[model samples]
Target chain A: MSRTQRSLQLAAYADGEVAQAQRAAIEQELAKSPVALREVEDIRAQRAALHRVFIEASPTAELSERIQARIREDRQRASGRTWRIGLASAFAAAAVIMMSVRLIGPELWHQELVSPPPLVARALAVDAVLGAHRVCSTLSDGTAHDEFRVGQKSIVEANRILKALRAMPKEGAALPDLSESKYALSSACACALVSNCEVVHATYNSADGVTLSVWMSDRPLALSGASKLRRVSGEGGRVYQVAEVAGGYSIVQWDERLASVVLCGEMPADQLLKIADRIQPFGSAARPTVGPRVAIVEMALLRRS
Target chain B: MSGKSFEEIALPHLDVLYRYARRLTPDAHAAEDLVQDTYLKAYKAFGKFELREFGVRPWLLKILHNTFLNGEAKKKHAAHSTEPQVLDTARAAAEIGSVEGDLRIDLDGLDDEVKRALEQLSPDFRSILLLWASMELSYQEIAEILSVPIGTVMSRLHRARQQMMTLLADYKFRGRGEPPNGREAT
Candidate 1:
């Protein structure tokens, strides 16, 4: 090859991308020409210099969370559009199923059908979307078993409910203050999908009768079909996911290091996002522990936000 | 691929992507946004192919580069004038006799000079150079990311290194082990 052609091939040779025959040819050129040898050395130096200069910036943990958050936003927007398109069709199909089941099988039905089951068997078998579906449609009443009063005012009541569910005790982590929210505390429940996998459900109602429920558990509900599920880094570095159920409700689930939380209501996406943003687990009032490395990271990011 | 597994594979490269993105767009905020947009796009379009460790880096970087280029167009901002400014500075230095008798670089200032010399190259040359030097991607992989033939990668890499060397060759180092103080040798 000519000197110029050989020079072009030298980079590929240095990068180990050239074929054996071409590599041999380039090696010959390197041996024969001192100028070519110097060129190769210059290329090596340039590579080292570039590495030293360019790759120094270390990305913050916030950057990863932010990237994940953007991905979640993109996915939600897409799935939201899909669900909107299928909303009418889904409702019609659901109505048909409900009517046919009710009309055909009186003996097969029970009053318990109106209450949310201890477990969303099918939803748990599928993903979180279907989990949301089961919670929204079946758990319409939003009542915690009568012992823990639905409208408890303090952390003691929340502790009572948590004990009932056998949830891990998180010092200083309390229910988000919703007094100024459009919704007020109305009902709460301790429900489980399977024994030992307890989830505490707290329901709130607005004057207009629109209800919002929050479920807190030790672990995020793990269902079989998880493709319908996603983890999002919500505002303030809170990781959450929004799954729109068949009914007109959106369920936003998140993890607070201390607990897994789910917020569900029939509200617009923006409204739900706003509520999610407000539901901080470790606000100044709570005075949460800053011991764990994870908690420290979360607290720092949340405080910044 | 599932979101969990995709996160496992892709999240580790967040810093790598951010570093490249920062170089592509000098503005820090713009670089962050670019990285965010790149991940968003990559996640939406990601498939089983990206599950492979080898394939994911180039794939993610391709998205980042394309996003940066498109973003520049969208914002109608000049595609970072650091290069032109550096070239102009170099030219004006030559004209005003910035180099006294010889082309001498203060040993401490070699890094800054090398960096400025890099900025003096066009985006295409700078990008190709950085990909090879900083990321150490294979020629085939760089070609794939840039959507150019492997031969083109070879040529560009050669030209980029040559340009930098030409710009830098005249500088005589002050001495070894001194931190760059950005001063001209008297």
Candidate 2:
């Protein structure tokens, strides 16, 4: 075979779709021709390189946003252009089942919240869009359907709710705070182009060491610092660590100003300040650039919202 | 699926999505755009999402793949460019700077050449290869994305690689001993 034909054959060979006899022929050709062999090598390297460069590229947050928008549109369209059909499931089977629309009225709400229906209703309004059928629609109960709209006040309210939850005692005390922060923070991450940290502290004793992780990605952040501990004139000494991460870095500043460790990482300085500024610790006003308190408030607002 | 609550539910995938977008769309603005589109779509469509049962990587890839393919992008932006804008790739490159444990990578100057060559393939073929590498989607997911039979997805990917090899004839690779073809490595 000529060198040109051999090159094309090499392409086919790389893709693993080449026929058995054809592969034998290519092998025979490769044994004799130096150029044919090189062509085969070139093809392999290129494919691997492409994977390296693009395979790991971060996907757009817009895709999720678009899908969300599509769902909303679909919901609206369904309300208008109903997909009418005979009740196939019930009709085909020997059963007369009638699902009720009163499921979402009030009873189940009280059970899930462990509070009276009035409390949930007073906390925030819940709008459940029912998936309907022909004639009439059945309103089904949803797990968590609360929506948080955009606005500074909305964010502040969400934070307050998050703080209340986080303040609950030891076992999963952080759960409420963590859950609330996710909705609000993810929305922000979507708006901005990167991930943000929800919390960081030495939850572990000295033996357990320090754990730093990017809240969204959950990949452990690599913490390294020349001096892990330092001494202060009046407050004495404390331990601190700086962690390395992709796209940004995190520092457990371990600020002793409040006699409590202040965990601060990379964020828009002004917004971080806004979150930190309002915290009123024990006796003092809520301080800006305050990581733990902000974490507390952010989580609270998320739960309440 | 682990029933780890909302925080643990989707937290694991943030980095993989971020990394995939950075490489697929070379421009930071484009990459950022793609990442946001993927997540926003994922968030709204979370009700339909079932993790592990339906592969998370491929499912996410399908969304991202579709986003780049059908994303309501402006007509003004160029398809792909070679210019090295600092902030866009600086962070991504720095992240993949060294493969720590199990991950092995040799990412360098070859990305532009690959991107340029892949552009020549038909849009369908282009999406197939891009999704294959980025999302690490299997043949099945590619079929779902392009709306082709699984067999067709396989055949097209094979052909796409060949077409890319042919296109590489025009471009150049950074200082390397042999051609990109795997015959040497094999």
Candidate 3:
């Protein structure tokens, strides 16, 4: 090697970076040349001087304490972030469960534990109407009833009962006029056939003495059953439950203006629904109608076997 | 890793790291800051550290080197208008034997002329000289710490020694009231 190359190797040699074989070679070259030996000595002297200069400069005594404090602070901040993330996750999970119960629990409950409200309401209406029809048939003779006095008395008695109960129909809604169907309004009174809630029982008699009974309640009646009933869509997008009761009676039940109305008779189901379509809330022409809104607890009860 | 275990294993190298940091930075406060940052980073990344044959000193040095470079980069970016050109001119002047006053003082012990000569070296050369002398790290270990090749480490150390010797010679001549560059005092 040339002198410059040999000189560069002396640096690595002084640093003790050369392999054992290279160390031996450099040592042999150093043995023959005073210039190479002096160069190595000068490098060592400079290295020692640098070591002494820097080794005397030490950090403050509190540097370690400061570093440890910083580490502790960092760890505390990380743990705080983890806690916040965990709390947020728990709240999010609870909200998801509540929304799930609100939106989907009722449907599953209806499918598994109880029949839907329309079916139970239909059956109850069938029983109540059948009983009322039997009572009215026994009470009334085959006489052509005076329409004006009975209609006027029906209104007076309905108002008196509503006043006594401290309840009013949402918009002055009264019994529908079924004169166009040849059924005259016969007798109207309050009865306790469906639950303890007061229900208005109104009977309409045709010229041939075919008896039809209608039941109206200010709130939804609570009923439970296992049998599903058929629903029919009527005019103005109203849904009606049509079902046949014992002793050849057909029932048509629907909701109007926060009141559940059930109409049942010994007539055909179609004829009953046609009569139902003619019924409307009496006072206001512009009152908005809403579908039945059953609470989740009310819809989730299991039917008694 | 647990903090206690990390302290047991790493705290012994605090003096070494601080010494090297002093060589790299301009002042004791900057050096302490650099050492604290190095320890914080090391603690965060402790889980990924494997106990190698060279131990944790080299690893800590690597973090210190990287943190110092990152700080320098941020400073360069913030002072983008004139700082870089000035640094370049200072480095060139240091190489050609004309160093500014600020780079010539600071660092206690030893002769004032020797301290000035030591301070006149650039950061890269000073780092190599410090690691090789004070820490006694091999060329391979220094290369690993600085993220450079072993050849570069060797050449930089050689050049750094040469520059230190030249600056010491100039300072010695000036101290004797003689003009530099082989001039007679008469």
Candidate number achieving the greatest DockQ relative to the actual structure: 1
Candidates arranged by lDDT, highest first:
3, 1, 2
| DockQ-based CAPRI category assigned to the predicted complex of candidate 1 | incorrect
What number of clashing residue pairs does each candidate have, in the order they appear? 3, 67, 0
> Considering lDDT, which of the candidate structures 1 and 2 is the better prediction for this target?
1
**Interface RMSD values for all candidates:** 18.3, 16.0, 34.7
Per-residue CA lDDT of candidate 3, range A1-305, in tens? 76446657887788787899989988998999876776787678667777787787887889999998998898888678657655655664575477456545445433421233242332353443444455444333111111111443454454344433333333245656677788877766554444444466677888897988877776554222213357899977777877765456777777654467778788788888888887774433423344455433334443321
lDDT of 2 by residue, A1-305 (tens): 65334444575676564789889988898899876666566555656777776554444566545544555675675465322212332332222122123233444222323221121101000000000000001001110111221122343343333333232111111211222222222111111001232221111111222211111111112222222323222112333333222333232323222222233333332332332232222213212222233434554555676
Candidate 2 TM-score, C-alpha based? 0.35
Best by TM-score: 3
Q: Which of 2 and 3 is the better model by TM-score?
A: 3
Q: Model 3 misses residue A195 by how many Å?
A: 76
**By descending TM-score, how would the candidates be arranged?**
3, 1, 2
By summed lDDT, which 10 consecutive residues of candidate 2 chain B come out lowest? B73-82
Docking class of 2: incorrect
